[model samples]
Target: MEAFRNAVRMVINRSSDDQQLDCVLMASVQKQLTEVADAVTSVWPLAALSDLERRECAKTSAVRRFPTRSIVYDDDRNSNEANAYFVLEGRCTCMQRLRVRKMTTNGRNRFALIRDHDGHGQSHNLDTQKNVQTVYVKMSDLRPGSVFGLGERRSGRVVIATADVKCLLVPLSFLSKHNGSNIWGRTVCSLDGTNPTIEQSFRKFVVENRWEEYKKSLANDLFRKRRP
Candidate 1:
């Protein structure tokens, strides 16, 4: 119980604040930790870690809270090589940015939205407006234990809080240093067994990288949808 409270304090990031990590809240904090662990069990990748490793990960991590619609990561500048996030509370959304040109067709006033896949491609002499609009498309809705932030699978992508969110910032360095098979390795956790049913396949879908056929998968969730 004390270990987990220290973990929370480490992430709370109020080094200057005097709010004590007192014994007074022991009962409440212990109950919360138990609930958080239950959520992590369903988050398979994190689940691969032994219970002790998972707790250690939190104790060494940084925790941050983001209010609704705040940006958690911006593909261009937000992540370092090992930077990743594990949702401990609430949810988030991954969005990808696209730039499109409005093309004037057949010298008439009709306009069409044309994708600029190459960024330099022309529309067969059609007049392309200099003012290209930037749009963000929803890639996925992330819940607890959902790990993200190692740059974008899609260029110009970002993760944003769909609701107020609290995430434990993990380096994901454990992938190369600790328990479980390499993410790319075909070896399976004996624990996953013959059949897998986690978060009704939402987590599996993300882990399998199947959402809209995205070739990349997030590591896993860390806890339940809500936390104290």
Candidate 2:
């Protein structure tokens, strides 16, 4: 056990400074794994785990390889036998069919009969029960650290490999049993859905630098809308 822990530490030490983020992520995972000796290591799919831990985990889990465009999950389906996947390599996109509803006006005051159907006979409200929309969200470009699985509600999101991909697949039942030691929620759930990664930082930087121009354009558009 000590040897395995040392091995993990060695890998962290060998990482270059440029890999600081990866190092931190690895260390954090290791720390969480220490709480449960027999539990599978909490390393991300791409991170290194001790040979012993890896082997033990594989006895119940699998490191599967997938071709490009493979479907990982389907939307709105019961995930009775679904597996949770941790991306070790390649990229995938999550597709979801969403229903959207919005109240719209045609610059008139009388309630439109084609609108609210709540038996109020009101004309201002419109029945929007059939407004369905589709949304496609890439899984952080198949980022190595992302976790999407049946247990994590991936059953409602369709995941498709955008590139040749490899992932660690674990049974949802096993994950549920060890849910206490699982850092999957803490690590992946904390992302704020904003701010690009380092590779995409330049785009965000450019946008920030041109904030004034964006503000002016927005203000001009709002002013135009308010004009008679």
Candidate 3:
């Protein structure tokens, strides 16, 4: 890391001193950029690209860090800023208000409906009754090798760091349907869907967000607001 800092300092000096590129300074900058490319390769499909290709990707990407409790992404507030994140360190919680319906279900093995007196029957064959109560729930935890935000945009989802976090921020264009590989093969899930790696990284998010605790309190919370 110090080498990267020194390389920048050297550039500053050369710009002011009108000095030429020396062998040592040139090597330092090249090495740092190469290291950055290695980190970019951790995301899928990019690894399959040639060295020059991924390095170009690295050039456009950035490393971002957030402190615990900081908002990493909020769809409502950050609509203009969109990208997929590759986790490098720590954890985050993803939250959203989702409508969840509690339903009472009853279905027997009988496929035929009861007929009327003149052999006339009901138009519908299924005999299921409906009783559902709707409520909202939200939240998650993210970890290393996990990715998010691609398929989650405009979803009212908010990602907050649960611990100090570090991530590789890659542009959405790399895997988007309009701009990327799915243009032909249509095999990969773009930002419109969660990546497999994101599934692994945030597997424990539901538990971390405490769904039961929220469910227990939701009714009381709504009553309090509605009564007034």
Which candidate number has the best lDDT?
A: 3
Each model's lDDT: 0.57, 0.54, 0.60
| For model 2, the run of ten residues with the poorest summed lDDT | 108-117
lDDT of 3 by residue, 1-228 (tens): 999999999989878665454566778777766666777877566677677777767887777789999988876677776567788889987765332222323521111112212245434322342322222234446788677755543345677888999888777765553345453133224433442232232333334335655676787799899995
| Clashing pairs counted in every model | 5, 8, 3
Residue 211, candidate 3: alpha-carbon lDDT: 61
The TM-score of predicted model 2 comes to 0.44
Error of 1 at 180 (Å): 1.7
TM-score of each: 0.50, 0.44, 0.50
* Angstrom error at residue 133, model 1: 2.3
lDDT (Cα) of model 2: 0.54
In the predicted model 1, the residue pairs found to clash are 11-63, 145-220, 145-221, 145-222, 146-221
Tell me how far the alpha carbon of residue 197 in candidate 2 is from the true structure, in angstroms, after superposition: 20
